[model samples]
Each structure stands twice: as C-alpha cells, then as structure tokens.
Target chain A: MESMEADILIVGGGAAGFACALEAAERGATVLVLEKQPETGGSSAMSGGCLAFAGTEMQREQGIEDSAELLANDLKQLGGTDADPALIAAFATHQLETYDWLKAHGQVFSPALEASSGQSVPRVHTVDPADMVRLLAARCRTTGKVTLLVETAARRLQHDPAAHRVTGVLAEGRDGPIDIRARNGVVLASGGFSRNPDLVRQFAPDCEHAVFVGGAGNVGDGLRMAWALGADLRDMAQIKGTFGKHPTDELNNHSCLCVYKGAIAVNQDGRRFVDESLSYKLLGAACLRQPYGAAFQILDEPILRSGDNEVRILDFERRLEEGLFIQADTLEGLARQIEVPEEMLTKTVADYNAYVDSGEDREFGRKHLVHNHGALRRIETAPFYAYPSTAAVYGTYCGLRVDPAMHVIDVFGERIEGLLAAGEVVGGFHGNAYMTGSALGKALVFGRIAARTALGAAAG
Target chain B: MQVVVLLAGVVDPKWRLDRLGLRPGTELADESGLPRRLSPFDEAALETALKLRDADPAVRVTAVLPGDVGSDALLRGVAAFRPDRAFRFDTSGLAPWDPRAAVRLLGLAVGAACGCPDLVLMGREFGDCDDGVLPAALAEAQGWRFCGLAHAVAIADGRFVAHRIRGPREELLRLPPPALVSITNDRGNRLRHPLMKNVMLAKRGPVEVVTPQAGAIPRAVVARSLAVVPPPQRGAGACRILSGPVDAQVAELAAYLRARRQAAAP
Candidate 1:
C-alpha cells in the first residue's frame, strides 16, 4: 500500500474536480486529484459544452442588456418553486466570473448565443467540452502544486470523528489500495449516478429504466460519499431526462431534433401526449409517460429543414443512413413500419396541422410567436418523418443539501464542519428541473468555493 | 495456407468501471446507458480480417465473442463487417474475467473447435482493462509463436510475416505453422467504415454458438470494484493567441513550451 498527502484532495477529475484543482492550486494550496479513468474528463468532456450564462462580458460586448438579478429570477422561474433561491443567487452572481475563469483558462467561447429548448434569453454558449478538459488537464500539469493520479478509484471517505471533518480518502489503483490524506478538505466532484440503476430507482423512480447518455463515470460516487459522511440529502427524487433511442443502437437524428425542438411527440397509439413546447426536463418526464416510456417525434420535411443542422434534419439524416433513424415517406407507411396506429397518427398529424395554421396551440397553449422550425413549426408540409424517441436520463438533480457557501448540512440543518461539496453531489440547487449550463456552471462555481474554504481551513 | 483472425470486442476504458461493477446491465446502453459504437481497436481487427479473407478466399475469418444473449445485436454488428462466420461464446457468467483466464479459455476452445488456426490475430490490448497481456498468454496456452504490436501482416510461402512497431523501430518477423499476433492501433491498415448495405446484410447473417467445455477453464484472478470518487476538473489559463507572422507565432509557441518545461521540472 502506498500513501500520499496533499493540502486539498479533490476526488473525481471531471469538470468540477479540474476547476477546483486549478483554483485551489492557483490560490497556493497543494492539490491532489484522483481520477478513476485512464484519462481525465468525465461526463463534462462528453457534453455539448454549452455554457448558459447571462450578463457575461461576451454578452455585454454583444450589447445584450442583461443583469445577474434577471438571470437569477429567470433561472428560478424556469426551475419552478423547488429551486433554491440562495444557490441560484450564488450561481447568478458568479455566472460572469465563471465565464471569465473559463476564458482565462484557455477556453474560447462562441460569440453568438444559441437558443436552448426552455431558456428565455439567448445565452447558450458552445465550446468543446473535451477541449476544455484537455486545457484544464494541461494547466493542472503545469502547476507544481497539483498531482494527478489516474486509474485510481476513490472508494471511501475517512472522516475525523471528533472534528467531524473529511480527512482522507481510500482508493484502489492499479498498484492496489492507496490512502490519500487531505490535510484540509475533500471535494466530491464526481458526477451523477445515472448509470447506477439501483440508485436511479431509489431516487429518481420516473427515470429508473430510462437510458443514459452522460458519462459512465458518474455512478453517484459523490452522493454516496456524502451519505456515508452523514450529510443530509434533498431533492432525491429529481432526475433530468433526455430524448433519444436505445443508446446501444445507432442514434436517430430526426426523432431527437423533432422532440427536442417542440415537434409533436406521439406514442404507438398515435396520440399527442404532452405539449411539445414545454421545457426539456418536462418533455423528458412526459416522454416517460408514454407506453414503455417510448414514443416518436413526428415532423414534416419543412420543419426538419428549418431546424438547426446539429439538432434537426442533419442529425436525422445521419442517423437514418447509419440505421439508427427510422423514416417513411407516408404517414401510414411510417405507422406500419414502427408498429403505430395509422388512423391515430393521421388524426394526430391533422390536428397538429390545424393548430399550426391557426397559430394557436389550444391543448398545450404553446406560444406560436417563435419562428424557429423545430419548436414552433407549422406542420402543414407533406412527406412527414418520424423517429423513435425514448427517455435518456442524465444525472439526477438530487443529493446532499448544502448552504449558500456550499457546505454540506446534516438532517437537523446544522452545518457539517470541514465537509463541503460541489457539482452533482450537492443537490437542492436544482429542484424538479435544471437550468441549461447550470450543472457545469455550478460545478465550476462551488468547486472554487469548496477549494477556497478548504484552503482557509488548512491555513487556520 | 489457411489463416484465421480472431476479432475480440473491447469496451471503452472510459466506462469500464460502470460496466463491470455498479451497472449490471450487459448492454452498452446499460453502462453509459448511451448509444455506443464499435470499439476502434476491434474495428481495426475486423478490417484486417476482411483484408486477409479477400486476399485468400480459402482463409476463413471467425469472430469469437464471449458475451450473453444481449450480445446478439453486437454479433449482428460484427457480421456487418462481413466476416465469413461468427461464433458467440456464452461466457457471460465468466465476465470480469482476468486476462489470463480469458486467454487460456479462448486458446483451449480454438484448439478444440477451429483446430489451431495457422495464425491468430488479436488487438494488442482491449481498451477497457488495457492489460496488454492477452496475446502472450494465449500464445503460451496454444504453444504458438507470439508477435506483439503488429502493424502489418501478410501470408506468403506457407508462412505469415508481420510488421511490428517497437517504439521508433519497425521490426518484421516471420512465424511458421501456429502463431499469435497482436495488432496495434497506429498500424498502417486503417479500419474502413461499414457501408449501410453491408450492415443490413450482416443483420441477417447466421451466427453459430459454441459452448465451452463445462468448467474446463479456471476462473479469472483479478477482482474489479468501483471507485466512488469522480475525476478532477482543473481549469487552464486562458489562451494567449499571438498575432503577426508565422515565425512570430512559432516563436511564441516555442517560448511557451520552454517556460512550461522549466515550470514542470522539479
């Protein structure tokens, strides 16, 4: 067995871990990062790299009039009543700083703000998550204060009982069991537990059997670690669902684009379920309401063409050619091919067309003012296309409860001294729904807070 | 001379822990629970096998996979590559098996069923475990010559010659009769993207099942467990893009590298 020591021991080298390591090391603390995979970049590396922030310097430069208060209010409203005001406030306040930090860290953001499904303002900034992770890893390597141990799995937390602090971690590496002692604090940036069916079943029952598209490394390690340390949990039932097909099979572009962009979602029975114009989190939950939590997004060629290349027709065409996308020229033909009810599908399409022509979505009250093809398209065009869609659950928006400073709390609402958390490990920031870019954004913000707090503790 | 190439399916090392431990689902969809494509290394092995089959019509390419019933789709996927015959070895219960145990079992089964192929082609290492020891173990078990990190291979004059990349050196070797060769990723032969027509045809191909002798192989030695901790996320300093002439950019890059190296030195 081998033993190592550091002033700050950050577990899980995904976006949060890397962010914390960089900040803590820059602040002059010796940082040790334990990564389970041969390479760094967990789920964050696999993401679309869309950072949704308001009042960013980039946004200001673009002359977009936005404020942190507005951003906070919008996030709270989008997330609904279950969202934590304090955490959301902290996130909004530090939103610009997070972007600045990323820019300072070698990440280049796109100038234009892309529209996400439910976001009110155009604030989605896209970058390559893999590139960001790579840049962070390279920078960490440059910092002499940081040491990265790859192919090492942190299994448990060793807490100081008298002091009620996380003192060290137990890990299994290629060499065997290794103990890593953090003189100050241990930050759990390991991602969510979507891959763990048992954990998903226990917490997010709605998406228990739903397929996942996020990082496989996110198996609820952070949540479990927090639980072991007696941290109180909240929003344990919240899970974010994505729209996709059986992940092992080829990806279907048409279905994903149509469903994500407000195309009518129908079951095999050929009936429209939920309002296509709802938020993605709600859409995912709605998709789960269908038969076996499986449905298809029905769209016409016009809508497909009008949608973004990445999210709409191009994705569908690619998937169709790859045998992942299922398509047909006629409504009846498609229904028969996918085993849906022809008459029901025809009626659904006809009714949808009626709604499109009138510019009034009576059933779902979908606003017709937006002109983007997928979400607000008129389904009057012929040669309709449909792709099988299902619930692809990512991380659960549930875990240990934390304060504004991101300190883990006990069941009695007492702060767990010397114990801090960030990223998906600490929930309640997101209630029933998550804000776009909030997961990665929160991971960056709280990870820094955790590091600074740990450094302060170490110095004391 | 007949040649047989063994195409083994390897999972992405990125999701190995989730696959073997917490996520008990056999489907790749179950691990990351996302749609997964074929492993690059396995695809390379398949490409090599197809090339060999094309070169020598008599040479039979057989894909031996140790998986369960859910692997039916995966087998169908491999068939898309146009192998002459596909064999699915039901070793699901023996999963998370150590490299040594898997190699020994595969050797015995190949010897009994396929009658010791003239040449066995395998990837240098599966992406998941990255043990990089399967070729040697299989070679030892079958009592055959072993060549590793093979980049190029060809059959000639009743023998097989292979080119291996050993660091900066390219070494060539010839093996007579029976031998095992491990293919490297950077090998000159590139894996071709499967055409849709081929994939459709593969879905309809017949896949034979070979059951290993009851308890004939030893259990795997290594035990894998999950690491509950997530990976670290360190941020990099912003990019300092230098504008001007190409020479100026190069100068800046050189200076940055030099400074980085100095900082890295203890």
Candidate 2:
C-alpha cells in the first residue's frame, strides 16, 4: 500500500475535523483530514447551524444575560443525572473561547438569540453551518500545513500491538488503497450514524420508523473503528429524534420547531399530547407513541409572524411558502382540512388559552414556550395554521465513550493510547435530552481540545 | 429475460454550485469538486428493472454506468442492489452534451460491455446534460421500439408493458423484446434501501471496469461553453403583514382573501 505521514491524521472532515485541523496547523503541526465524500462538511453542514455559547457579544447585544455557569447548570438540569459532569464542565469552560476563535477565523453568526430545548436564557449563536465549515476548511488550507484529502475513506485504524497505540489509518482513496501514518495522534471525527439504518435499528430502535436526515457520509465509521478496538460506548440508549419533521417534505431537511415560539402540538385526536415546553427530542418521543407517529403544530398569526428567516428551525414563512402548513380562516376549517374533530380542537384551543390567561398549565404543566424561556402566548388570532409534523433522527447523539480531554477510553476504563475522538462520534455530553445547539458546539469545543491535548502530549 | 439499465448519476441538487465552468479548451463541464447522487429519474429506472427481476426469477438485470473514475462509487452503490452484473465504462474524453454522439458511444459501450440486452432502460434525461433526448435517439439508432417517461414496466405474455403519464391521463403501451423504455420517477418505483451487508460487500468487492470499444461518431451538437447562473426568480410579490386590532386585522385579511379568490374564479 502507498504510504504517507503527517503530524496529525483526522478522519471525517465535518466541523470537528476542520476545527481540529485548523488548531493543529496553527500550532505548527502538519495535519491530514480524510473526507470520504467528494465534498467536505458532513452532518455539521446539514445541521440547523445553531451553536450553544454563553456570555457572548451577540447575547449581550441582544440584552440577554447569560453566563457559562448558568449554561452548565441548565445543561445538567435538562440532561438530568445521566450526563457526564466532566464533559459538561469542559464544554462550559471552553465554549466562550471557542466562540471567539470561530469569529476570529471569519465565522459569522446572526445577532439574534434563540432559547430552545435546554436553555434558561437565549444563547443560540446561529450561522450558516455549511458556510462555517467552508470557512474553517479554507483557513486550514491557508495554513499550508493541512492536507484535506476528499474522496478518501479511512477503512481501519493501524494499531501498534507492542506500544498499544493507534499509529495511523488504512484508507481507500480515489486512486487506490493507502496507509497514512500520524506521528502525533489519530482523531476520529467521523460524526454520527444517522444514515446507517442497521446501526439506528440496533441502538435507537424506537426511532426506526422516524424520518432520517443528516449527512450522506455519516455511517458511524468512527464509532465502528473505535468499537473494534474495544472502546466503551456512552448514551447509546439515549438516542432521541427531533420533532416537527414533515413526513413527506422533500425540499427542506431541517425540522420546523414552532412549539419553541408558543405553538401547541396536537395529535390526530385534536388534543394536546405532551407539554410543548419540553425539548423537541422529548416531544418527538411522545409523538411517536401517538397514532401513526404524527402530530400537528397549531399556531396563530402572531406566532407565524414571530418566525425569523435567519434561523433555520424558525423559518416558518419558507415552510409556508413550500405549502407545508395548512392555513384556514377558522379553527373549524383547519380541523376539517387536517381531518381532526372540530369540537375537540376547539375545546383544546379554549383550554390552552385559559391556561395562558391563568398563567398556569393545568395539563402537562407547561409554563414557558421552550425549556425555561419565553412567556406563553395565547393562540387566538386568525387565520390559524396547522403544520403536519413527525419526528426525524437528525444525528445519533451516542457513540464511543471519551474523557473530557477527548482521549478514547476502553470499556475497562483505560484511555486508548494515541487515539482521540470528537464531534458526534464521542458521546457523554448530552445524556438524557438534547439541547438545540449543543451538538455543533460540542464539535467545535471538543475538537479544539482534542487537538491541544494531542499536541501537548506529543510535546511532553 | 435480460435487461440493461443505464445509470447516469447527476450532480446532487442540494449542492450550491459556487463555481462552474467549462474546462479550458474543452467542452466538458468541470464538475471536479461537486457531489453527485443517483437522481430520482435514475432511481426510478433502476427500481423498475429491480421490480421486474423481483417478479421473475428468470430475469437477469445488469446495470451499466458510463463515466470516469468519479462514478465508481455510484457503480458500487448500484452493485449493492445485487444486479446480475454491474460495470462502468470509460468516458474519459467524451461529453454527453452532444446527444447524437452520446447515443452512438453509449450504444457501443452497452453492446460491448454488456451482451445484447433483450430490453434497455434509462432515465428520461441521460445524466445532467441531456434534456430528454438521448434514450429515444439511441433506440431509434439501434432500430428498437421506444417508450418515454414510463413510470413502471412489467412482463406480460412474453412482452414488456410500460405505463406512462402523458398530459392528462396514464397510457399503457406494450412492446416485445429488444426495446427501450425511458423512466420517470413515481411513488410506485421508489428505490428500495440496500441492505447493510450488501453495502459492505460492495465496498470491499472489486468493481468491474470495462474499456468501451472506441469508434468515431459524427457529432450533431456540441457545447461551446457553459456557466453556472442563478435560477430566474418567480415573483410571488412581497409579503404584507397586517397591523391593527386582532378583530380588524382578521376582517381586513378576510376581505383581501375573498377578493383574491374572486379574481381567481373562472
């Protein structure tokens, strides 16, 4: 096999791989990023492009007070006891610095702050995810030390039995098979297995029938490669799907999260099924148990007007233009169009409005729009709207277990030498429930940490 | 029964082409960095062939793709379907923009790489270049019966019956062996997901690469240049958000909607 060498060899060129490469290259280390697809930007590019950060300029500019400590507390409270405290702490520690690093590297974020899923305050730093990946990839190229090889898929890790270290990777390139050696370390940033049906069925079997969306190249290559070496896995059973995906929507891949802005989700029976204030992932679980795994997001004119086109999940106008939402002058008409009982829907709306007026949700105990943010708004204005919704597995949030330093750990609680992982490939960040922007945030923060940890060890 | 399905993968529609141009001093459009996927039409054609094979154990389906090395992965994806035989022919210096020449070259590749196929299948548009002409032209050149925009195909009474939508109604046409049918995507012919085991096997297995028998064909059409341009915007008019009390706004909105509906009435 043909052979090549670099100071750092990274697999999968999504946000994590690119971030790792840029960090390593800037620190005077030569890096090689292997992207299996013809193009870069894996699932990170396919995401809604929201990044979770605390105490940023955007948050302050929007007059929203947020801090790393509050962010950490909210994550713990939302994720519950299952989340690894160390990883959560690491994210909270480096989130602000990573945000600044991204900005300094030409990443642009919209000035709007959104509170979704697990946030006490609005801190979702949104950007064009595909543009961010392209920007980072370009920065890596300008360093003159990182070689991004597209259409090159890493087949297996080359391990040294005596040293007990992962030396490099055996990959299949466009021309033929090649063996690449990493002098410092090998980082697995191959993202999640959202597109791999078998892996999805094996882990998140409950979400098997849910719609699948994400990068075409995300087939759990890194997870399988690390697992072959007996790496411990975490949060595999906690894989959850995002609610509000239209079952037949071919134009848009992202979900429409109207519930986060004060819309109620109702089942075919025209009755509220779950508290809309819960994270969309939890809502997705509840939705799947309903008849036909389907629900409708009921919103009013004011809620529809609250959509921000800059945010992917909140871009309700675009979804409306695509004819994904049913608009009716009256609630009865909406019920007729969606084939639900008019009386039950009317009663449901009346009850919800009463809860909104009384400042208490008697059923499901919902107070905020999402998590602990946004005041509840009564959906009384017309014309009303109903968005047909289903759950979609955006990314598998469970994978090989790793320390906060990003070193792959064995099932026996030993760190595998010279092996590191980041991004969706390494789990333990989100335990029981998913935060809206944390996946991309974890990719950026942990990716930089992995690079620093690897280079620091090499220097020592 | 033997069938040959022509698979011409298109550049993934999801990708925003930041830069696209013709290769210097050549008519070939440079698509070096763009991602490609099996288009709906290609999937429809392949699935129709697979459905036929599923109904009859005697049927042998072979998938043939004509492209350079970049399309090898696409061939492997096709191979995951476990066709009787799947292969890719060299299209190093050929451009499919010239429909007449493409038909001749494709005919040669099919005849040489895959044996004489009892029935030929392809999408309405061959690759991203052809605009629904190559299949019919190829069939005419080979002197075989032709059907276009077929949604599904089946065997009945030792002949192929093709179903297609034409204008307002669905049309069913029957033809004997040695025929060509161009397929259009439909719910009935949606491509089935490949098994993970077969996907892994195809990844490890060696892909059969065939060198097409080259012969000069006179070109009737040639692409001089190509450039990526933004699609024309169809103005639906700007959105007007209403302002006032909830009751007044609803009344005004109702009036506007009623007026618009009246204007739309025949």
Please give the TM-score that candidate 1 achieves against the real structure: 0.64
By TM-score, how accurate is candidate 2?
0.66
DockQ of each: 0.03, 0.02
Predictions in order: lDDT:
0.70, 0.89
The best candidate in terms of lDDT: 2
Summarize candidate 1's per-residue lDDT along A66-117 as a digit string, tens digits: 6787768767776777778898888888778888888887788755664555
lDDT of 2: 0.89
TM-score of chain A of each: 0.90, 0.99
Model 2, B1-266: lDDT tens per residue? 88999889988888887767887777777877776778888999999998899789799998988888888888888998889999997787678877778898889767854567888999988888887889999999998899999999999998999999989999999999889999999877877655333555788899888776565656777778787667676568656678743335768999989999999999
Clashing pairs in 2: none
TM-score of chain A of 1: 0.90
Cα misplacement distance, residue A426 of candidate 2 (Å): 1.0
Interface RMSD of each: 11.2, 16.6
Candidate 2 lDDT by residue in tens digits, A1-460: 7999999999999999999999999999999999999788999999999999999988887888999999999889878887899999999999999999999997888977888888889888899999999899889989999998888999999998777789999999999999999999999999999999999999998996588999999999999998999899999998888998986556789999999999999998999999998878889999888776788999999999999888999999998876678789999989876778999999999999999999989999998988999999999999999998889999898898999999999999998899999999988889888888999999999999999999999999
lDDT of 2 at A316: 97
The segments of candidate 1 whose C-alpha lies over 4 angstroms from its true place after superposition are A57-65, A245-255, A260-262, A309-323, A368-375, A456-460, B1-266
